[model samples]
Target: MTKRFMTTGLSRRSVLAAALGGIAVPALATRPATAALAVGTAESYVPIAVGAGGGPAGSDRVHVLKVGPDTAHTVLVLVPGMFGAANDFRLLARDLVAQVPGVQVWAFDRREESLADRTGFTTTDPAAYYLDGHYRSLDPATSAFAGHWGLARTLCDLRAVVLAAAGGGRRRVVLGGHSWGATTAMAYAAWDFDGSPGYDQLSALVLMDGGVRGAFAGNGEPVEDSPEQVRERLAAIDGGAVFDLSLSAVGLGSRAESTQIWYQLAGWYAHRDPDGPSVLQPRMPDALRPPVPVTNAALLGVLVDSGFGWPNDISVHSGHLAVSGDVRGWVDTGITPISRVATAYAGGPEPAVWEWYWPARLSVDLDVADAYTDTDLTRSLGLRLFHSGGLDVPLFVFQTSYAQGTIESAAREVVASSRIPYAAYETDNGMNHLDPLFAAPERNTLTTSLPSFITGLR
Candidate 1:
């Protein structure tokens, strides 16, 4: 079995040769290059050097899915949700090109350095960042970089990506995001970079299943986690050593089996024991196994076996949760199901264990002292955007009747206050947070309206 180890210090040739030579390799080897899809689109991953924000600064990759020719077209820059990979938008990006005709979609892959599995010190250091079931802080002050990963750096990185993608000059750019990505999008929209409006670079904003403020207390209304609550959710991710953050938060069903499947697909864990046959062997069908030992980069077969007793035919084995059903109850509910998947499939990806340590550090770094002094009306999109003077850009918010409360009221206020035309589309199609991006094009409710809404932009 091929062992995926997260180590540094060797020459690039040594590492690559070891990986090719079937020796111990870093987690980077597990990341498979995305194959170009058949949807008449070209996919290119561009790396942008991001200056330090909250931690050791490095380059972040942006995945561009360009449809038609490479000439100028409306660009929709999408940021993935927390810990989100750009590949999550693969299907949606291709579909948008077909539906909208000229618009190209670029999805950002945020900081992945922590995936090194070592303390954030010199790359050569071998101390595991995660020790004793808790992720240790690796911030410069704490461990390596000046700041850890903070929302400030996140916003800055996104801005840099926008400028770079625009080829320097301003163009019609619609900044969009999903879930936490939507939160970042809203934060980006509100930030006044260089003492000017942050939304200046954005022509419009498209938020899906996130950026809702009504759910928070200091965020204008009292939801569950009040501003006084001190966002422990992200912190919990930092302190907690187990990497079982709910994928259900992003609309995946909350089934332990499915979560295992998702993590396995990410190469977060090993499917095989180092000595014996794969621990996942008995659970998987013979047809699904690759000819060689199942490498982390192997195509993860969607769990389609009904014999496995999984409700949905989707590749993962989430219990009864439908991929498109109401999954909000599971978001932040904190009730993680016991993983029913076998032990081998349940191992943690070495890099993920280390990466979780810094996400909280980044959050803490972005948390400014005076931020609370500025209300959402003037400084941010708190639970909603009010009629602010500078928010003249077009905005489109898509929501389901069940999940529309987060931004509808605020979106209306912004539209009524400004001359900018906006649209809030709602449906009762039982879409969860993930449906808009991952659902099949025809099965997805929000995607159908995208063509008209985008083309309608003046």
Candidate 2:
């Protein structure tokens, strides 16, 4: 009811507070104080992992990030996308807490995160873990146990997080996620928890630019990954190549995930030393490197902002490199600050924002997706998506420009078949895959709409 998240007359806009050195947080921004509100939140992580024999040392103990007061009545549990960690939703969690008086956000790091080596992030120089390889990555051989980190294991562990959020049925819970995380939400809804349907435990669902459409929409034609194909992939994982930084399926090439850490380092450099010479540049191939020598922020802008000329679907409208600087500078688009993007990647000692060692099996199991978890094969694969069509919880879907087709179809099918109450909104401005989470507090569509959705639920 209170519009405290937005203010009318604010004139100064600055970036990053003087922390240990730098943090691209929008300090005293000219607009509403939404971006500034991101900082100073009480955040903590607690291990709530389930299942047996997970990868790495502590990979079995998945940590759920808890933001906001424990007294909040409603909890929105979020799962990150492919190769993602809980910190990915840090901005959104802070924003949600600011807007709603009674809501809390619970986000979790996936199982394979145990493979991410954050040892490099602690070094004095961000580039210590860069191309020269000062921080050696985990040997894929050591992570052979990830071969069993499939949807089944993930769901079982996530169920523990959800149950903790539920607080022994005392708190109302809403489930949600981004990209692959959103798809995981759908799978969880369809999933059968013991004998009970997954949807029975939640009050509502929030899908941000991710959904399940016609995964197996064909009559008799085979799905993307058959049972035999899944078996062969598992055999390969057993042979030692456990980490899956490959993203060839998106036509984006294997370079996508392989260079994901380059972003973590790049973001750190940008936030730590915005004006410093680009540490990420030297590590990049000649083709991907900026044509002209650039600064740390400029290199980050090049990687994520399409306006800077890199052509990829993951690009969002963060801002452009300042044209005047001889070494190039960054200008925040105001929609999502470039500094926020940098902070999201490499700001502090928080849990990793990117999962460098994404389990190959989770993606493999999803290739044979069952839209509603209504198939016998779905149970066999451990997906447990038992009955999505029967979902009775309120559905809130916010479609973005980057990935709308599948979300639209999925929203339509669920609303029609289940005849449940639902709300669907479209992104008018240029919003990308990652924008919904990082957009400025007031300008963020989710921050503005989610409170009403959560409160409106019956």
Candidate 3:
């Protein structure tokens, strides 16, 4: 393996300090929790049951909160990022309803009630618990794999929630997600669930600060690096000592706790940059960018300590300036210029730094093989956007030039390659991978842009 970096005593202390200072970070709101009707208004936080049958192998009763005008024109379903609770979208929902006048918005809790209760229903560790409960044990002989929730299952669950919210009636439905949630939204859209009834309810999809095609292909095909090559790559970056320190400082908590902490920390790091333009710079390399430093610090503090200090390790490069300017031009005017958001979002020292530290600190083996596979998966799914054969509905794809990898590019490529009628746009104000949904005030420039995008769709 690789020589591990040991941030044992002093490093831990510094990290703890930095993490603590980064708490209470806020982002834009994407959903509403409660709303009042006009004079004779009737409002209720109705809990709609979602899932096939009483309970599948590892299924839980999903609950969605719907709030807005009773006679709404369309239903918008918002999905939160990893480690985020359904309530995270409340602000966004409310804002959309206010802007659209008669539109209903629904945000669902993806966590199974049992898992939610055990982990306090937060964003972290939901996947771990899902894996432990659903996919931990498998007779490889009979079962394909063992994990509580995979991309496919999550997509199915989302589809179920949408159908339940519609109450069997056909209506225009807009689907949106932030970060991993955005991935989930795209997966559902690209999924070829032909015989299933859920496919019919989708009207549009919104991908906010989410990576495009080749950036997230984890389990599809082999591209360049062989499995052996990936093993070698992992060997180069494995940091056992760092992981030991991290685990020791944090302690070996429940899978849920550990996962939750990881999510919070990742979020903290993503939003660490304050200057939007600077944050947008990294995307040029990866076609994606990171969020503001304040946001990243707050998220990290919540995960690491209750009082972490924000780090000042921001990098200044010409790549950022070029990408930031491109993104700004795209959003201010509905124009598709030759810009690179996915590259900027994905480009950055942080992800590379994480690659170096992650193997040692988290025991993750990210190799070229994994990267290639992820890219392949992204490309495969991207191809689905072309043929309206599966989902015959109006498709709205929102891309930001501040992202990295093949996310924005692949999305653009798919749109261009598909010859399908679609509405695609890129954000200009330099949003990072998670900024579209996690920006503060829920009413800032970032959040404001979403309503207009959705309204234009109507």
Among these predictions, the greatest TM-score belongs to 2
Model 3 regions lying over 4 Å from their true place: 1-12, 15-47, 50-59, 111-113, 118-148, 194-199, 215-254, 259-402, 428-430, 440-443
Cα lDDT tens digits, model 3, 60-85, are 55556575765776788877544444
Query: Residues 24-128, candidate 2, lDDT per residue (tens digit)?
Result: 423223335443364576788777756766454566677888898899999999988766788888888998887777888998887666655566678887565
TM-score per prediction, in order, is 0.58, 0.84, 0.52
Model 2, CA-based lDDT = 0.68
What is residue 371's positional error in candidate 3, in angstroms? Answer: 12
* Stretches of candidate 1 exceeding 4 Å from the true structure: 1-38, 54-69, 113-147, 215-228, 231-358, 361-389, 401-404, 416-419
| Candidate lDDT values, in order | 0.44, 0.68, 0.39
Winner on lDDT between 1 and 3 is 1
Ranking by TM-score: 2, 1, 3
Which candidate gets the maximum lDDT versus the true structure?
Answer: 2
Cα RMSD (Å) per model? Answer: 14.0, 8.6, 13.8
lDDT by residue (184-272, candidate 1, tens digit) is 67667766677766677777888765553431111232232334334454445445422333333322233212332334332322223
